[model samples]
Target: MNPVLSSSEVGVKINEWYKMIRQFSVPDAEILKAEVEQEIQRMEEDEYLLIYFSLMKFRHQLMLDYLEPVTTRIRPTIDELLEKIETSNKGISGLLSYYSLFFRGMYEFDKKQYMKAIYYYREAEKQLIHVPDEIERAEFHFKLAEAYYGMKQSHVSMHHVKQALDIYNQYELYKVRKVQCMFVISGNYIDFKRYEKSQPHLEKALELSRELNNKRLISSALYNLGTNFADSGDYEQAEVFMKQAVEITEKEKLTNLPHSLFSYAKILFKQGKMNEAIQVSKKGLSAALYQGDELFAKLQGYLKALYVDAVDQHGVNQTIEYLEKNKNYSYVEDIACETAAAYANSKEFETSYVYHQKMVETQTQIQRGECLYDF
Candidate 1:
C-alpha cells in the first residue's frame, strides 16, 4: 500500500487506480479519487508520478460526468489543476506535457468543440515520441478517432480506430479498448449503410462485452444491432434488440437510455404504431433534455418525423420552430425534406416547393462539407 517506497510500486499503483476510477459512476470514482490522492501525496517527491496522478483524477471526473450526464459544468478544481500543470517545468517529464495536452483535448471534446479537440490531439500526438508505452499511444489514437467521429469524418475516424485496435490486439489489458474500437468501426460502416459489414462487429462486441460483464457495453452493442436491423428493414429483429437495450439502460440508469429510446421510437414509427411512437419519443425527448441541449437536438428530429406523420401541419411547424430556435444543423437537411413532403401530401404546392428548394440547398451544402447551419 506504500506507493513512495519504490518507483515500480508507484507505477503499479497508478495503473490499478486508473482502472478502478474508470468505473461508470460518480460514487465509485469518488472512492478511487480519495485513495489515489492519498498515495500521490505520499509520493510527493516523484513529480512525474504526481502529474500523472493529477491527470488521472481529472479524467476520473470527466468520465463520471460523461456517464451520468448530470451537468456540463467543468469543475474549478480541474481548471486549477491544469494551471498547476502549465506552470510546472515541462522538461521534468514528457508524460507531463503529453497528459496536459491530452486532458485539454478531452475537455474541448466534452464541450463538442471537435475541431479544437483534434488540434490538441495532434499536439499531444507529437509528444508521443517520448512515450514508449504502446498502450498509451493506442489510447491517444482511440481519442483521436472519437474526435473525428464527432466531426462526422468517418473515414478518418476509422483509420485511427484501426490503429488503436492493432495496438490493443497485442495487449490483454487493452481488451476493453479493443471492443470499443470495434464498436466505432461498426458505427462507421453503419454510417455508410453497410449494415452487413457492421453486423459482425456488433456481434463480436456483444460477445466481448458479455465476457467482460460490462452492462453498458452490452447495451451499446444491442442498440447498434437494433439500428442495423431497422436500417435493413427487419422490423421484427430491430424491435426485439432495441427493446432489450431499452430495458437494460432504464434498469441501470445508463447514459445511453435516451438514444436507445429514440431508436426504438423510430422503429415504432416505421411500423405505423404512431401512438406508441409518440409516447416513446416524448419520454426520449425529456431524457435528452435532461442530458443536454445537444442530445435534445438529435432526439427532436425523430419526434419531428413522428409528428409529421401522425399529427398535422401545425405539429410539423412546431418541430420546425424548435429546430430553428436550437440551431441544430445536423438535422436541418432532413427536416427540410420532411417538411416539403408533408406539405406536398396536403396539396400546399407553394409551401412544398419552397421547402423542397431549401432541402436541396441544405443537401448541397452538406455534400460539400460546408457548415450550412449553426450547430
Candidate 2:
C-alpha cells in the first residue's frame, strides 16, 4: 500500500496503523510504519509531530533498542511539560497531554494515591482521542494499567499492560514508558507474592532506568526490586535497595524518603532490636511528617506502638497527643487505646460504668451523624 502520504493522508494512516497494530499483524504493519516515517522525514517540519508519530505510531519497540544512556536531557522534558500543563493551552497539544498525564500520574502512583492518579490517567486518555495515534493509545492503556495496579487491581491491570507491550513489540515503540510498564507488571507479581514472576520485569526496569538516566524511575525500580527481596525475607538484598532509596533521596534532596527508612525499621524490629526499631521509626517519621503527611500518620501509629511496647508511658502519651492534634488517629488502632481502657477498667467499678456509658453515647453519635446535625 501507500507508505508516504500527504498531511491529511498522514493523519488517516496514523489511525489506520493504530488499528492494525492492535490487531497484531506485524509484518503488514511495518511496511506502513516505514512509509509513515519516510513521509514524516520528507516534510520540512519543525514540530514534534513526527517524533510523536515515531513514538505514538509504533509505540516504542525499536526505540527501546536505540535508547542511549539516560542523562539530564530527559529532565527538561519533564520540566517543560510541567510548565505548559499548569493550565490548558493549545500549544500543549493532545499528544503531549497524553504524555503529561502519564508523567504526573506515575508521580501520583508513587505517592500511593491510586484513585487520584487514575483520575489523571482518564484525563490523558480523553486527550488521546483527538490524535487518533496507535502507539500513544497503547501507551495510554498501559499507564491506566499502572494506575489500576497501584490500586491493587492486578488482573485488569495486567491485561492493559500486556496490550501496551504487545503493541510496542508489534509496532516497535520501545520508549522508556514501555520499559516502565514491564517494571510495573513485575510489581503486580510482587504484590501477589510471586517473586519468581517479578524478576524479569525488575531486571528490565533496572536496565532501562539506567539507559534513561531517569533518577525518579531508577530509584522506584530499585525500590521495587529490593522489595521483592525483602518480601522473600532476603534482608541482605532488601538492604541494598533500601540503601539506594536513601542515596537517591540525599542526592535529590527529595522529601519522600520514608519508605526506605520504614523498611529498615521493620528489618530491625524483626531482629528483636527494639531500640533500633524505635530509632528508625523516629527517623522515618521525622522525614515523613514534612514530606508525606498521609503516610506519616500511619508511621506515627507504629512509632506509638513501639513506645508502648518499650514501656515508655510518657512517650506513649506524647505520641497519642500528637495523633490527636493531627486529628488523624483511630481509637481502636493500637493497644495503646486498649491499655488506656484497661487503666480505666482497673479503676473503681462506678468509674468504669460511667466510661462504658460514654462509649454507648459515642457509638450512637457515630451511627447518626445526621441526627447530631439536626439537633
Candidate 3:
C-alpha cells in the first residue's frame, strides 16, 4: 500500500487515532499511530495540519501512560515537545492552543500535581469557545472534575461532574465516559459521607463496566464500593469488595494495582488485623517502590508507622511534615484528626489538643486555598 497521502487523508486518520485514544483502545491507537506517521513522513507544507498531528501524538503518549503507567524513570519528552511547540509557534489555531493547555493539564494530573493541573485546565477553559464539539467539551469537564477530586475539592469536582455527565448521557458512544463520570460522582458522594447515595452510582457504574467489558472500570467501581462500605462502618463488606478489586487489578496488572493494595491495607488496619495489614502494606510498598510511586510509598509507610509499628508522635509528625511539604493539606488534616482521636482514646488530653489544633489549622489552610477556585 502507498504510504504517502494527501494532507486531508492523513488528517482523517489522525482523527481516528484521537477517537481510539478517547475510547482507551490502545491496540487500535498504536496501529493508527504508525499509519498516521507513515503518511506524515516525506510530506512538507500544511504546517497547521502538522501541528495538529504533533498535538495528537502528544495526547497518544498521555493515553498510553494513563492505561499502563510507566514503570521506569523516563525523560520528560512531553515537556520537551510542549516547550518546542510553544517556542516555534508564530500563530497556532485556537484549537491547537486549547489542546496544548489541556494536554499539559493531563500530564500534570498524571504526575499528581493537582493544583497545576487545575490551573492549566482553567486556562484551557478560556479557549473552549473555539471548540464546538460538545463531546470534547464534556471530556474537558470530566478531566477538570478529576483534578478537583484529586485535591479533595469534592464540591468543585461535583460541579464539573454534573456538566460532563449531562453531556455524556446524551451520547450512546460515550458510555465509557459516562461510567467515569459516575465514578467521580460516587467519589464525591463518598467524600460527603453520603454512602447510601454513593452506592447506587457505583452499582450503576459496575453494571455499565461489565456491560462494556472494561476491566479497569470494573475494578474502580469495586474499589469505590469498598470505600463506601468502609466509611459507613461495614468492615466485612468493605473487605469483600476491596479484596475483589485488588484481585482483579493484580490479575490484570492494571495501573491502579498499587493504589488498590494501599487502600486494602488501610481497610485491614481499620479491622484491627495488624499482622495482615502489615503484610499487605509490605506488598503494596514493594510494588510502589518498583513503580517509583513515591506518594504510595510514603502513604504506606505512614500506615505502617501508625498501626504496624508502635504509634508515636514522632512517626505521626514525620508523616504530617511530608504531606505538608508536598502541599497535600487534605491528607495533613485527615491524619491530624485521626491522630488527635487516637491520643484522646489513650487519655492523653494535652497531646490530643495539640493534634486537634493542627487539624483545625490544616483545614483552614485547605479551605482558604480552595476558595480561589470556588465556582
Candidate 4:
C-alpha cells in the first residue's frame, strides 16, 4: 500500500494509465504488467482506488482479449471486473457504469453473442448522457456498429458507423478510427449489394490505411474491395485484390487468413479454375477449423459448393453430415439443394426428390425467420 497517497490521488494515477491504454499508447507491455500488478496490490488498502483500478484493468484486458484468437484465458479477469463493478457505491459506480456496460458489450461481442452485445450496448447508451466525452461516445457508437454488423443488420450497422464517423471527423487525432468507420460503412454497402456505393469507401480506406502503414487495415480494405468486386461479377478485379489480401494475411499471421483465402478461392471458382479452387478451398477449410466456429461454418459453405461443382458427391456427403451433426440450420437449405442436384445428375431420382423436399422446407423456414442458426 502507498501510505502517502489518498484514494483520489490513486484514482488520478489510474485514470492517466487508463487513458494511455485507450489511446493505444502503452509503452512497454512487461513494464505495464508489473505496474498494473503493483497498483492492484495497493488497491487492497483503498476502496476508491480499487474501483478505478479494476475499471482501468478491465478496459485494458478487454482490448487485449479482443485481439486474441482465443478468449478462455481472460474469462476469470472479466468475471472479477464485473463483480467489482456490481458491488461498488453510487458515486464510484456512476463514474464507472458506462465503461462497465461497454466492456460487457465487448465481452459478448468477442464471444459472438451479437444480440447480447447489442443489449449491453443499449444499456451503455443510456449512461452516455452523463458521459460528456465526444471521443468516448464515438468509440461506443463504433462498437455498437460492430455488434449490429455481426448480427447482419447492415442498415443499423451503417447508421451507427456514420454517427461514429461524424464525431471522429471533428478531431484530427481520431483519423484512424474515422478510417475504420469508413471500412465498416463500405462493408455495410457490400452486405446490401450496393457495390457502386462501396467502391469509394474502400478506395478511401485503402489510401488511409496505406498512409498509416497499418498492414491489418490495408489487408482488410483490400479484402472488402475484393468481396465487393466479386459480388458485382468482376472476377478479374476480385482475384487481384483478394490475392493481395491473402498474401498480407499469410505474411502477417492475421486472423483473417482463412476468410481471405476463401474469398480468393471463390474468385478462382468463378473464373473456372476448378482444380485451383478446390485445392485452395481445402487449405482454407483447414485454417478456418483452427480459427473459430464462425469461420469454420463459412468455409464449410465454400467447400460444399466446390464439391458440388467438382462432382465429388462423397465430399458433399461428408460436409452435409458435419452440418447436420452440428445442427447448422442456416446452411441446411443450400446443402440440401446442392445434394439434390448432385443426385439428379447421377439419375438417382428418389434420393434427389427427398433432398429437394428438404431444401424447400428449409427455405420456407428461413423466409419465415423461424430458423435457429444465424451467420
Candidate 5:
C-alpha cells in the first residue's frame, strides 16, 4: 500500500503481475496492474524497468483481448509499443529483447498469422538463454506449440506441448495452462487421424475445465470433442456435443459462438438434416458478420451457397478465389475436393474434372512452400 517504491520492488511487483496475467487471474491482475502502473511513474529514471513494464502491459492487453476478442484494442497500441521498444536508444538487455520477439509472436498468433507467429517464436527461442526461469521457458514452448498446431505441424506441436505440459503439471498455480496443453495435445492427435487416441486428453481437459468452473474451456472442450466425432463419421454423437457447445457459447456470449455454430451446421449436414443445417449455417453467418470475422463470414457464405436450392457453382468459385488470395490453401483444397466428389456423384464429369484440377493445384502449392510450413 506504499505509494512510492524502489526500482527493484517495482520489478518484483511487475513480475508478479506477469504471473497473474498468464494464469488468467483477471481481477487480481487488474488490481495489481493499476498498482504497478502507479509505481512505475515514480521510477521513470530506470529505462530497463520502463521497457519491462511496457512489455508486460502489452501482454496484459493480450490476455484481455483473448477474453473479448471482438472488443480488442491491440492493433494500434501493439504497433506503437513495438515502435517505441525498437527505437529506444538505450541498449536493450537480453531479456528485454527476448520479450520483444516473443510478445510480437503472440500478437501475430492473435491475428491468426500462424507462419509469422512461428517466425517470431523461433527467433525468440534463440534468446531462451536470457530467460532464466524454467516456467518462462515453458510459456515459450506452449506458445510455440500453439503456433505449430495452428499451422498443422502436428509432430512439432506435440513435441512442444509435451515440454510445456511437463513443466506446467509441476505447478498447482498453472491449472489453466495444463488444460490448454491438453487441448493442444488432443488437437494434434485429431489431426494425425488418431481419433481414439485423442479422446482421453479431451475427456481430461473437460474434467479439469469443469473443476475450474471455466465456461470458456468447457465450451472449447465440447467443441473439439464434437469435431473429433464428426471427423470420425459419428455425426449423432458430434451433434450432441456441438449443440451443448453452441448453447454454452451463445448463452455466455463467448467469442467462439460463431465457430461452434459453424461446426454444428456441418454436423447437421453430415447427418442429412438439411433444413436444420441451413438454419444453423445462416445463424453462424449472421454471427460472423456481426463480429466482423471476415474469415468465418466467407466460410459460412460458401456453406450457405452450397446449402441453398442448387449448388451455386459461381459462388463456390468466387469464395475459393477469395480463400486462395488469403493463402488459405488447406481450406481451398478441402472445399475443392468436396466439390469434385459431389460433381462426380452427380455425373457432371466436366465440372468434377475442373474441381479435381483445382484441388491438385492447391495440393501442389501446399507442397511447394507457397503454403504450409512457410517459415
Candidate 6:
C-alpha cells in the first residue's frame, strides 16, 4: 500500500501477483477474482501497472464474450501495456507482455480485422512460453485458431484447433473444447461447399451439445446444419434444423438468432412460401442489422424475389414497393436482378426498370471498390 515502496518489496509483490495470474482459470470465475484482486493491489501502488491488469481483466471477460462484445476502453489499455512492456518491474514483465499481446490481438478480432487479429494472436501464443497452465495454453491456441478461421485460413485453423483439442482432452475439458472446434469446422465445411461432409460434424456437435445441455452450442450447431441444407436447396431439411435453431436461440436470447432466421426465410422463399418467408425475413433482418452485420441485402433480395409468389398471395403492389425500396442492396445481385425481372413480368415495367438500373449502378460501383450508398 506504500506510495514509495522499495524495489525489492515491489518485486516480491509482483511475484505474488504473477503466480496468481499465471494460474488463472479458463472459463472459470473463481480464479479470476484472486488474480484481479492482487492486480488491483499492484495498481493502487503503481498507476502505470494498472494498464496491464485492466487488459488482463478484459481477456478474462472474453471467456464470456459469447455474452458481450469487448469494451472500447480495452483498446487504449492495450496501448499502454505494450508501451510499458520494457523497463517495467522484472517480476511482472513477462506476464504483462503476454497479456498485452493477447489483448491487442483480441482487439483486432473485435474490430473484425481478421488478419491483424491472427498476427496478434500468434504473438500471444509465443508469449505463452512460460505459462504453466495447460488448460490456459489450450485456450490461447484455440483462440488463435478461431482468428485464423475468420481470415479463411482453413488448414492453419484446423491445426490450431486440433492442438487445443489435445490439451483440452488431456485436462478433461473435452466437451467444452470439442463443441467449439466442431461448430467452426462444420462451418468450414460449408465454406468449402461440401454439404454432405459437413452434416456429420454438425450432427455430432449438436448431439454433444444436447447431451451436455449446452443451449448455445446446440443452437449454433442446429443453425449451421440448417444453413448448409438451405444453401444446397434442401429446404425441407433446412426448415427443420433452422426452426430448431430459432427455438433455442430465442429461448436463450442468443444475439445470432437472426442469422438463423435469415437462413430459414431464404429456404421458405425458395419454396414459394411467400407469406411465411416475408414474415421471417423482416424479423431476421431487423436483428442482423441491429448487430451491425450486413444481412439486409440478402433478406431484401429474398422479399423481392418473392414478387411472383407475393403477387399470387400478398399482391403485386406490396411486392413492388418492397423491391423499389431495396433495389440496390449488395451481396445478392443475382437475386436483385431476378426481382427486377419479376416486377417487369408483373407488368410494372417502369418500376421494374428502375430496379434494373439501380442494381447495375450498384454492381458497377462494387466492382470498382467504390462506396455504393449515399449515406
Per-residue lDDT for 1-375 in model 2, tens only? 534445666766666665555443356566777777777766545345553464444242322212222121122233344654453345666665676666566555555555556777767767777756567667678868876765556676898898888777764535456667877799789767799989888878888778766665677777777778877878777877767866775476554467667766666664566776777778877777755455555655555554435434455456555544432222312324334454465664554454455445433433332121111
Q: Which wins on TM-score, candidate 4 or candidate 6?
A: 4
Clashes per candidate, residues 3 or more apart or on different chains: 0, 11, 0, 0, 0, 0
- Model 5 poorest ten-residue lDDT run: 366-375
Clashing pairs in 1: none
- lDDT pick, better of 2 and 4: 4
Better of 2 and 3 by TM-score: 3
**lDDT string, candidate 5, 1-375, tens digits:** 446567999999999999998898888999999999888877647777888888899899888766644544443466788788778744675788899889999988876677778888888877899998889999999999998877667788899999999999898988889989998998889878899999999999999999989888899999999988987888899999999999988877777877788889978876779998999998999898887677788888777666664568988888898887767676788789878887888899999999999999987775563443434
Model 4 score (lDDT): 0.71
Off by over 4 Å in 5: 1-4, 68-76, 90-93, 360-375
Residue-level lDDT of model 3, residues 134-172, one tens digit each, is: 888999999999988877788989999999989988878
TM-score of each: 0.77, 0.53, 0.92, 0.75, 0.90, 0.64
Regarding lDDT, does 1 or 2 come out ahead?
1
lDDT (Cα, 0-100) at 258 in candidate 4: 72
Maximum-TM-score candidate: 3
Where model 4 places Cα greater than 4 Å from the true spot, the runs are 26-36, 47-52, 65-95, 292-294, 305-375
Q: What is the lDDT of candidate 6?
A: 0.63
Tens digit per residue, CA lDDT, model 6, 1-375: 436444445445544444333333233443544645654554436644554555555555444455422221222444555555544554454655677777788767765555567667766666687677676677677777777666445666778888887776665435756778787676667656788888898888888888877777788888888888876768898999889889887777665666677677777877888788788877877776766554343444445536434533233334334433533223334454656777787898887786688668656644443221124
Q: Which portions of model 1 show Cα errors greater than 4 Å? A: 1-12, 19-35, 45-49, 63-80, 83-93, 292-294, 301-375
Predictions in order: lDDT:
0.73, 0.60, 0.84, 0.71, 0.84, 0.63
lDDT of model 5 at position 116: 79
| CA shift of 318, model 5, Å | 3.0
